[model samples]
Target: MDVDTDIDKHFQQLQDQKRMLLMAKSRKGEVPRDRKPPQVAYHQFMMSHMFRAGLAQSNENMIRSAFVPPAYQPCTTPIMKLQPIKINQLQLETHHRGRYIVLKVMTPPMRMTGILALGADANGDIVLLHMYNQEEENVREATDIVDVGMIVLVKEPYYKLTASKDYALRVDHLSDMVRLNEDDTMIPPQWMSRISEIHDSFEPHKAKADASMKKEKWWKAIRDYTAAIELGPPPDRLEIIKRNRALAYLKTKQYDAALADTGWPGFGPQPAEKALFRAAEALYHLRRFSESVAVLETLHATFPDNAQATFNLERAQKRHTEEETGCYDFKALQREAEHICPPHLDHATYIGPIKMKETAYKGRGLFVTKRVKAGDLLLCEKAFALAYVPERDEERSAGNGDITLLINIETEKGFMGGQADLIRIIAQKMYLNPSVAPAFTSLYHGDYGATPITFVDGNPVVDTFLIERTMALNVFGCPNSSLATHKRAMNNESMVDNVYHSCGIWPQASLINHSCTCSARRSFIGDMMVVRATRDLEPGDEVTFWYQIPHFKANMRDKLKGWGFVCDCALCQDAKQTKATVKKERTKLRAALTEKCNSPVPSHKAMERLIDKLEATYAVSPDLVPRLGHWDAQMQVARIYAAKGNMDQAFKSACKVLVFLGFSLDDSKKGFEIKKWGMVLDYLIDAFMFIGSALIELKALASAKKAYQYAKTVYRIVVGEDETFEKTYEDHVF
Candidate 1:
């Protein structure tokens, strides 16, 4: 008995020693990395066992259900099935012909101006149904609700002779079609059996296609859908498959393929109205504005009340007009830009005569093929990809619950994740349209090297790391125009609480070299970038735009950090040669001039001295200073002259500023207004207002009235006609 007790005590001592060792290791933070504690081990073991059992049971249930199909579940609402008529038995009789028939969709619904489908009855007799003049609400609701293998009850469907001279059914009203669920008892057993077989054959491919779509594997989705389509399901199912394939093609930027799938034969007129609309959309993207317009016009003639058709038709017409005329109304563009979420301008492309050429040091640079005068449109580019950065609070809710997932993208600004959001969107776009991957990858990735991953569906997937580097080097930050911001401010309730800083990629614009004294200026109208020559340039002159303001106080090294290059532009080179004494003198003069301009009532002598000093500095070292700074100095001098009631001097000084802005203001004219001012529209407005106010003080009422009128015209051009501007100075000229 004593020996038995001693053995038990020894076992207890061993157990205690094991526990103590474990506790010491844990306290020292040296717990065995691969081992779990007893509690955790037990919990994990139970979870694994339960998971296995549940999975087994699920598989068993699935197997059982596959063999013995569940009973048809009826819809909660009672539906009376009209007497079904066989497809082949239809006759062209006024009363007896137009009867209800139950049919299953064998093809996808093809949309043009209307939804078209070919459905089959239990007898395997097929008929085409053209649902035209569908209401917008009904079409939107039907997008997800209508699909292949759907059992629908058609009521009051009239027969029509197609171009092929075949009899078909026409369904016009939304009420005429009632789509029944898979388990609906309304489906005939004979039809159900056939549908079940078709479903079984197509299920695998369909599932794969759906999974690929969710993963944004557009090419895979297209391939799978095409395979399923070739299997020859019913007419409605075929249409559905074709539609899905078309969507995949569209996402991949294969506009031609998309159009073909929408029912446009290689050589023929437009297909059904439903498919025609899609063709028009594809044509629009391909920049075939005229073709798109023609199709839209035909669709509009058929369904004048279709809002979407009308809207697209008008847009096509506008794009066609712009392409032909090379003219754009800024007022209309501003209105579009003011939207919180603006529609993409995918139809816009590079419209100027510029080409990319390799440079000695710079990888590539844009060059002018023709002489460009000041204010000439150099390049108008649409963003390849873009995103609006929401406010801090709204960032959590901005995207479709994927915002947090996207925040993991690495960026230089580590904790500041706004750029990650933009790159995330670019990645999503690339995923949807893998064909654009080449163009996106062709962009300079700065210092970051590409880390290649395994190919997906035979195409290399874009790395987020490459995208982050490219975006950092090339993204343009566009602020909302003052006019847009002002309009938003006017309507408090309608205001978009977040001020979105738009980031966009202009692949072509990214080629323009950087210069402190740039010859071109860029502006944004929505996501579209419009670049105009700030100075005249001869043919073969490299087009350059300022990446950073020339007057910025930072040295070249500091300013060029983001650009990842030392600017060897003329201005920077000249700065290197300038004497320290001259630099100090210039800096002091600039400070004095700035102080004078900020004063409420600056002396005319002091302003004159400031302008003189600026002129001297420019004359001595033209390359060291920007002409824009000189223009600003002149503007201040003009304001000082105007304040001193020196109208003549003010007009002359203002004209100097106009010359720098690429405008020739002739004071000898009655109105003293040029036909066009090359200055930015916003600055032009201010210049005219200042000139008009000075004229009013000079008692030149007639001239002042003309100036005000010009201001009003410009105001109309900048802001849309929705709001009227109250005239500050009124005059009546008979």
Candidate 2:
């Protein structure tokens, strides 16, 4: 018969034998004396017949010849026949002079973040290979090219010698290693014959022994099962082995790998019921609750009487609904302020209302394409990477040797400079997520020239100087608010003191230029920074925010030193032309206002004089006097009126305080929710309470109740469900 006809006949005979054995077992009411199943026996019988016929030299070769087409081989080059030395022969005495070696992998590749892997050859010789290149594109390509149990040809291999004298072959370039498939014609016949013997004799016995010892020695069981699977066991046995490996993977917290073993296509037949249940459990641990629920639903449909499947299905469904609605407590991220804030608050990152553009004077600036009003959210940014600056006392008192040693090592490696710890953290983040490297490289690195170097794959290096300079010009120092500070206390003692500052890079927000008279003010709610318009802005307006405190006594020169720029903004330019006059006037006005504010019982006339002095000083140069002082002056006037029992004047003054702090009387005009206010929240809440008390004294009961309710809402947002403030306000109003 022709080859095709003969193969079909062989398969038909095996099927017939399997059917007869299964029938005999059913009649006898147990597996006939031998413990082997019909499917396993049939596979072994077919393999033995092929070996005796000599149509192919080994069972693996025979199976490949029957299934794989000659024209569809993985590699089609005659150069593959250039015989390579075995991995066992790769020693420093003979092969260290850059000789090539060919190896068939025996164990699963141990990958370290997709950059490097430790692989074992057929003879159990381990070698280290670097899998990434200098460019991020090349690094991603290398990760996709390598896998476990593939035959590979390495060229010009070198040894990396260590203190213990244990050496490994290193392959650096993508061209140095070539992956080969089992069906390739250039495979050496002797190696194939030995592999077949090892598979039949050693692998089956090893699998049985490992399965027996699985309960007490699960880690070893997983290793042995992986080896057996790589050796090409019989089809029925392969399914059983994969299921066993999946269970061990789940126990070890390797959820992704466990899911792959149970559900990956072409590994073997469909996994049995037990394996499917294990896959659902794996998905649940990975926090993919929706997928876990779906898998459990399928299991319940197939086996309606399964009590465990029903219980798990209900649990997964409930968790999936909670995750979709953001109802969980977020317990894992309580200490991390950046993670405590929900991503949905940052609309500018996900929503497109503004774009960055290049300017002649400013390197880059953010411009608004849509019209925005006062109290509108112009931008909300989440940090790309963040690191906390430890308090001076905490650093000196730290007891962990590993942390101290790491700092010393970094200093020796030349990462020590201004903000070196922050630079190191950002560099490590870029290395771990290569896709973000391109955006990071595009950021403006201050006036320093490029420092390029040759690439080494295994020991990848980042430019620390460039990272430090970029961060110096761009990072925002965010203060932890009272709300975030209280939440952070649930996780660690290090963050209990709210005085520590956390620094981070908001890549898009960095484009906004500095302005003393900024149109927008920035506030932090956890790690989320919300930028709202302090005044109405038209389309095409350059969106700007304050880089430093606007009311500080320092001149523009001192404030702009770290930024490496001159004072060119309208306020700075005005101050520059009349520096002496502006400085003298600001000092006089501030001194007068401070004295009046500190009085035990200030008169209404003195408060009115303070407001007039602030208005006149603002007229000279608005930037010289910050807007925060104006709000403080208005609050003082309101307190003076309330103290004198002048309810009408107190209500008007409180309303002005709210407006100056970026609150709108018309609720429809406000862009941001009241809960998003940062440091100003406490002041805003107090102003509302004052307004409510004044209206009550005036006998406007309905208006008074509305104002009190708004105050309660803001208080609830800041302190969560604790109702101490709400109860006190209600009792006072009643």
Best by TM-score: 1
Where is model 2 poorest over a 10-residue stretch in terms of lDDT? 64-73
Model 1 C-alpha lDDT per residue in residues 377-442, reported as the tens digit of each score = 777666787655432335434431222111111121321223434554576566444555666678
Clashing residue pairs in candidate 2 are none
Task: Count clashing residue pairs per candidate.
Answer: 22, 0
lDDT at position 347, candidate 2: 14
Those runs of model 1 whose alpha carbons end farther than 4 Å from true positions after fitting are: 1-199, 203-240, 244-279, 282-314, 340-347, 390-418, 445-455, 458-460, 482-500, 596-601, 610-624, 627-634, 655-685, 688-734
